[model samples]
Target: MHIQLVRHATLRVAYKGRTLLVDPMLSLAGELPATVNTPNQRPNPGVELPMPAEEVLGGVDAILITHTHTDHLDEAAVKQLPKHLPIFCQPPDREKLQNHGFEQVIVVESEYVWEGIQLYRTGGRHGTGEIGEKMGPVSGFVLQAEGEPTLYLAGDTIWCEEVEHALKSHRPDVIVPFAGAAHFLVGDPITMTKEDIVQLAQAAPGSQVFVAHMEVWNHCLLSRDELREHLTNNHLSERVQVPQDGEKIEYKR
Candidate 1:
């Protein structure tokens, strides 16, 4: 499988003979406003896309949306993506995508199969307390295909019971966790922190962990350098990979 980090949580994954784009935020840097109630109110997407948006999306076959958050699925994405292409998302987002003129919106409630790939939906908590509640429903996915390694895409979530359960149940060979320690002015981080990544590496000792969702937005406080340093200090540098924007990594069974 080939996975390319397109910036922040967006990924271009080529697996099982299909190219799936995950969480596409296609706007140019600073096109969007800053996230409210957080430090560093600079315009969102602090950096530009490693390549042009069209080039990044050139060969994609489908889209997998973990949630409908603007940072994950933005206005540019809605305008740019082909309406006829299949879009797989959680239940709550089905109508929203349809409303946006998406033609084929598939809701992966628990498990779904499409063109030989198995997609299993899993739960997640975007945050805690009222913020988490306000963040609303979110999901992750476990993807499996013949002759390929199992992959777990842990969506926007912190270290929670649901995430631990997904790790235990799927035992994925490749794990991608959205990490940035993204938080607001008055709450714990909504996304995985460096400490959470360490815990995840320990739990899934055999799985290769790749970190994403860092250094793109103002709310995401954790930088790639900081995360790499933390991993080295914790003796997990070999197990966890912090990929730069547009960097692609290949995995084999």
Candidate 2:
């Protein structure tokens, strides 16, 4: 199996004769609005896309979009992706993507199988009550390919009851969590905190945990070095992996 970490929350996964692009956000620098809301708010200073959108994503079989946030699903990528490519997303998000011109859209449910891979839905919350409602509903995904290791992709979420239930139900071989503890002014940290990641590593015994969605945006509070240190201190360094942008890792089973 080949997994390449492309930037904030974006990944390319290859397994079972298919390559799936998860959340392709390839916007030009300074195109996105400031993620952190404040009195003197500054716009988000976006990073340059490592490669041309088409060349990097040349032969993708499908796309998995967790949500419609601009950072996770940019308009440019949405327009550029082939209309024939199968797009997988939640029901509401499907409506949004469909409007953008994707001809094949799949509304992910609790469980579904597509292209030689099995996808299982895992619940996720964006934030607390009013704050979370403002953010919107989020869902995680568990993907399993025959003869390959199972992987769990935890979308933007904190350590909540629903997430715990999903972990208990299915023990995946790998876990990809959005860390960095992102916050916007008054609300508490919305995404997973460093401590939450430590707990996640403990919960899934022997599972290789890949931490993403950190450092790229201004709102994110944790750094790759800091997370690495925490994992080391807890004696969980071996299990935790923090990949840099444009980095790739392959796992064989």
The 10 consecutive residues of candidate 1 with the worst lDDT sum are 51-60
User: Top model by TM-score, which number?
Assistant: 1
Off by over 4 Å in 1: none
- In model 2, where is the ten-residue run with the lowest total lDDT? 38-47
Misplaced by over 4 Å in model 2 are 36-42
lDDT of 1 by residue, 79-173 (tens): 99999999999999999999999999999999999989999998889999999999999999999999999999999999899999999998999
Per lDDT, the best of the predicted structures is: 1
| Backbone clash total, candidate 2 | 0
lDDT of 1 at 36: 98
Give the per-residue lDDT digits (tens) of candidate 2, residues 1-253: 8788888888998878899999888777677777757322445434666667776587899999888887788787877788888988887787788788889999987888997899988888887878888999888999998899888899989888877887888788888998888877887777898898998888887689888888666688788899899889999988788998888888776
